[model samples]
Target: MECAAVSAPVSSHPPPSQINTSPEGKKPPEHLRRIIGEPPGPIVALLTRGVWALLTALSPAARDALARFVGNLAYTLGIRRKVALDNLAQAMPEKSEAERRAIARGAYITMARVVVESLPAGDRMTPDWDKQGIEGEEAWAALKAHVATGKGVLLATAHFGNWELVGQMLIRFGVPLNALVRPLKGALNTRIAENRLGAGAGLIYPKGAIQEITDAVNRGESAFMLLDQALPAKAAVFVPFFGRLASTTPAMAVAAERTGAPVFVVMGVRPPGPGARFRLEVEGPIPAPKPGEFADPITEHTARVTAALERAIRRHPEQWLWLHRRWKVQPPAALVTAPSPGLTSGPAPESAPKV
Candidate 1:
């Protein structure tokens, strides 16, 4: 179904899916707001805020260099450094170890920039998002047009580039967008979550949100969904990413198929320069499958969308977070290997333990 024709949005928030929204800043009367688990909440909060402040204090150019330097250093020493390198090797098999290492190093810096831009202070510093960043004008225009057409845009993006900045950029330009915010326990996590909301984005708790997301789209509002993470077998549909069967969520695909909502990809891509500035592009309205071509239309569509994400990441290998254990879940026996002629199919091998 095409989403290029609606004229109005149906709701400001999410689904009648009756989701539980986060309580970030408001101090309720109960001690329920205090640190739920361990890890010394006070220290973690202080360090996070302090780093945010320090990054803010530096000039844009200086901080940009520092972010990259720190990222590289962290990658060199990080427990997950090998993970990142391994991911890169698998994702870009043609690349040599040195090349993969370079990509991994750049990924750490990209992550640093992600962390910095996500900080509350970063929002304060970036008052002129339009002036500093370029491109994405057409993409944003497409999003506005799609949502205006009445089929609310089903936003699809990966954890590449400055993913968060895409929302911030839209908020800067007065476009309303909502995305799922993972619920983290503890008062500090709440505050950080609140800060994100305060910076001009809306949140939708993940549980029970199908109809809620549909309702939001029906209203001509846009909801952002990150589809590049590793999903559990229960929630996952194995899809080819970098030529491997990585478990991916089919929620967006199913939503589009079920509701006829238009799907769009909104990803943040930063150009090469001294400072971290993004070209937050929102592109798509991926056409629905014609049906009967694949065994499952949902898996086909999900894989198609994921392929688009892979293409985007390929363009800027350094910007994607390679440190993540994106391939932790192995393909099931049926998909991993076919039975040899006159022989039985073998079970899939186990993956290496995560670091």
Candidate 2:
């Protein structure tokens, strides 16, 4: 059982505490530390732009190959390797460490492939859902029902699975969608926008996407939001995920509360087969908040979505993204869940023990 190398545990040897310990300046609690944080800054934006430009300039074959190469290299170097394995260990508490590490490696490789596969135009993209094991009958039915009523629909998704195909699949299957996205920093952002829109789906920028979402619902257009990432302190809710508390955004729940539109959770799965074929699966209106509760739908919807994502990750432990710092910060008091027995109060476990 081989595991990639990662930084020492935050528990065994505390890295410099990100929180301020000064008495005059109130120190943020453990939970609050994980919840609030910002995305990459201007310098990060610049690097992303450079990468995006380089990737876009490559030929399709070259791009795909590069994706595969990156995945392989990540596994060898063990960069964020522990993060991926630790996440898997939590997601699948019953699995052996060896099995969990295998899954994490596979997931990294698959994500790399997905990044490139999403590069081609809708028509040019290969590995159709039908061939890849995508059984979207239920989602299609739900889409038709909402479209017929002319009330609009919200499709909530996460970083899990091959989500890139949602828009393409929707278009090919007769459900055109408008997706909401966090605009990327530089050139990468520009290319992602172009490539994504090239598939015939409408996209709204996240900074001021609220109005667009409202308008889309009013106009009866479907919308998609990747809601699995951690949220800012004021906007997050700590939810039980894989027996651990994780800060989650409540946007999906809030959207449903406001629009009266149905919610459909969708994921792109990598089918069990040869080279790297994938599938798309759609599940549930998953029961949104009842008639009365409307104050914080983001927290509510986020919990439901996180629960669903946990289930999916457990099913395909190796396909989820583990490289990214999904749990970099902790949530505040209002957002924290009841503490688990073994989890210490100071900081999250840097390296989880295998079952």
Candidate 3:
């Protein structure tokens, strides 16, 4: 799975420009600019770079241990602790309190490790797939088949284990991949964009990205979209997740239905061990909707893809991002009684308590 044969991508798209310069169209004081560099204060800049250097310098095992330590500390400090526990309680009532607590702690650890692992720059961003033991032959085949049609491919993913690595793996497999990402703030945004582009993946910002995504796909390029995030009711279709209706964006489904592109749910799984390389799990080219496939193919497609993600998360509950308010938006009472287009029929759960 070494990508030695894969050449660096020569993208026609322009690289993301730096946007961290002074706000008033004025330059920062020379000394301050030299030290802090951008909107994030000097202390933050130094701290971020310091942590990155420390994590990068450590061996993989040590890095994992340190990440675990940070995660445990966060859990102990009650950082989003209630949100995680509440999510677990709602999503996995079958599990005992002790089990759920362990899962929450592990979830924190996974999040920490994701951040730490993502901080490395350049070639280190591309993992050794053989070392990771990523099993994706079927997925690769499906991707190739979809791309061969020249209709493009919709790669549906989530905030599950090492999601960043999944995109890198796709690029390594020589898939011309573009991802829809929410931009970070200040210098961090520029740095992350640079890293993604450096890894040979194109970045698609969420604002006004629909047309761009469609155009990119029209050109036979694959687009990666994270389908698990919570969205406003107007922008989302209700779908069953863990026995509750979660407000989910139907972008992937809409794109697939509109463009005749195949949708594949891909994620990375972290096997239990010290410094274990993540395993790639790809499920789909999920069956496309037939004409008049019941009603509202877009909603049905969204549910099917959401179900795929739910199955993956169930396999490793701790690896999924439990801290996010996944079930935050509930359908209005009228819609709950008489479900509208793009909505599944269900009694809305009480809205998630504000964090």
TM-score list, all predictions:
0.77, 0.72, 0.80
> Looking at candidate 3, what is the lDDT of residue 109?
94
- lDDT tens readout by residue for model 3, 92-153: 99999999999999899988887766666633432334355434556546666676666568
| lDDT by residue (tens digit), candidate 1, 1-355 | 0000212221122222211222222222222122222333787778766765776677777767767777978987875998998788788999998998888888889887766555545343332345543334455566676644655567887778766666555444434556655556654455545554554445665576577677766655566778878878878888788877888888888888877876766666776676545665544555566866556778777876776677678777888878789989886898778411211112211210111
Pull out the clashing pairs in model 1.
5-149, 6-148, 6-149, 6-150, 9-219, 9-220, 10-219, 15-212, 263-285
Model 2 scores worst on lDDT over the 10 consecutive residues at 1-10
Model 3 vs. true fold: TM? 0.80
Write the candidate numbers in order of decreasing lDDT: 3, 1, 2
Model 3 accuracy (lDDT, Cα) = 0.67
> How well does candidate 3 score on lDDT at residue 102?
96
Query: In candidate 2, what are the lDDT values of residues 41-113, reduced to their tens digit?
Result: 6788677766656655666557657776888888889888888877776667788888877887787877777
Quote model 1's TM-score: 0.77
Candidates sorted on TM-score, descending: 3, 1, 2
lDDT for 279 (candidate 3): 68
Candidate 3: Cα lDDT at 329: 97
